[model samples]
Target: MPQHLLLIEDDARLASMVAEYLEQSGFSVNHCGDGLSGLAHLTQPPAGAAPELVVLDLMLPDIDGLEVCRRIRALPAPLSTVPVLMLTAKGDAMDRIIGLEIGADDYLPKPFEPRELLARIRAILRRKVDNPAPNGKTLRFGTLEIDRDARTVTVAGAACDLTSYQFDLLVALAERAGRVLTRDQIMEAVRGRELDAFDRSIDVHMGRIRAAIEADPKDPKRILTVRGVGYVFARQQD
Candidate 1:
């Protein structure tokens, strides 16, 4: 099946153009002009299709774009892993930083080139699919069990739902627990080679992971910061 797309943009003209263009590109597109319906549409998995990517406008008629993004992030499973590319006029440094920080995989400013959006969509999808994830396949960390094949992780009998990226990140740290992995190293291991401005994205991803796995993200005992060097997944087998 072709990749699916959910577009939540309030502009009628923009929405129509984007939907038509994406459909021509062999992607099945669903367009919603308001945020409420857009979010409601995602609550249940589609009968036969789920979106592979979402293009969300930051300004919505009902819910704000950031809330929509967070709600999407809170979703359990395949949905959570779906890449979200934010649409906003706020494309400056701080806006971009916050978007990535708040869980968007990518953000595009208004008046963007259609071609650029398409390219970014491809990149995000490829990044997700090509990365090696050790969770669903299988993992054994004492009483901690990760079944990547099933997309489930359990620690001490408590089930924890994690995004695909989060699970993969944890697996990398678990595999090298006690070893310090620089930001660049972690990026290479989990998210491909380090990009010039991709460091903050890593921090956000790690923070999300720590929130899921650690009892505390503020002062984590599981994943520790090594001051200026990088991070170390605390050695648990001591």
Candidate 2:
């Protein structure tokens, strides 16, 4: 089946251009020009027509993209799992960081190279299929819990929603608790590939996971940064 893409951008020309390019790249693209309409379209997709990916624009006519992302995360199945790539004209690091902090799988500045957007989209999809830990499987460690099978994580049994990357990071650390895995090892284990740019995406994912599952993300107990080596999940004796 051809992968489906939902592009939510208010700019008519940009929306058309992206749809055409993505379709040319073998994707079935759907465009929603306004935030309210985008949410409406998302609420009612075609029969069994969940999108494989979403391209979200930060500035929307009705609601901000950040709010949309939040709502999407609050969704169940198909919609919640759909990978999102945020588009913003803001190039500042803070803006980029905010997008990531708000659960965007990836971020691209406006006037981005089409190829780069496609690369990111492909990378996210690859990670989604290749990672395979977010299908409602749960792994528990003391007060910490990871439910990949349901994609629902809990800290002290409190429900938490995690992105695909965040879930993989926790699983990597938890699955190898008490042992130090180098950043490279964690990357390979989570991404299933050798690093191309050696990006700190692993660290970013870890931050999000810890923020969700730890009482203190700054000083996490469940997942510990081992200074020079890498990271280890704090072993809890059964």
Candidate 3:
């Protein structure tokens, strides 16, 4: 079956164009003009059907796009876990950073090409469906435990709250514990793309992940930053 997508964009023209393009590309697209209605669609999806992804615009009629993204993240699981791709007209770095920090799976600046949008959507979906790690594999390091199949992480027996992207980032680091990976390496491994110059989305995401899994995010022990390099997952958690 074609994938289902919810597009929360206030621009009527843009929404119609995007919906048509995505539909031609073999997706079922539902468009909502405002944030509140969009949130409702996400929260109370059709009785038996829910969108596989959300393409959210940063500008909205009711609530700001950022707030909408937060509300989506706050939803109960499987809903909260749905991937979000943020669309913004803003070229500011902070906007993209904030979007990713708030659990958006990907970000696209406005006036983007339809093809690129399609590619990004495909990439995010790929990450959702493809599990690189062997099934049933679990990585244990002292108080931290990562279950590959379950896609869950726990520190000291307490479950950590992580977005889908954050969970993937953590798994990528833990799978190669003790080996330092550059930002390029980490992004490519988890996102299937190289880091964009001046884009600190990865760093923002790392900070969020640390906050979720580390006993003290300010001084993380599991994911250590290497000066002038990238980051590493400690082999020994003690």
Decreasing lDDT order of the candidates: 3, 2, 1
Q: Candidates' TM-scores? A: 0.78, 0.81, 0.96
Pairs that collide in candidate 2 are 135-149, 136-148, 136-149, 136-150, 137-148, 137-149
How many angstroms is residue 12 displaced in model 1 relative to the true structure, after the best TM-score fit? 2.5
TM-score, model 3 to reference: 0.96
Ranking by TM-score: 3, 2, 1
lDDT of 2 at 53: 81
lDDT of 3 by residue, 67-150 (tens): 998998888777888889999875867888888888898899988999999999998888877787775589899989998778
| Between candidates 2 and 3, the TM-score winner | 3
Candidate 3 weakest lDDT stretch, 10 residues = 191-200
Of 2 and 3, the candidate ranking higher by lDDT = 3
Q: Please tell me which predicted candidate would have the highest lDDT against the true structure.
A: 3
The models' CA-based lDDT, in order, is 0.75, 0.77, 0.88
lDDT of candidate 1 at residue 234, scale 0 to 100: 69
Tell me the lDDT of model 3 at 166: 82
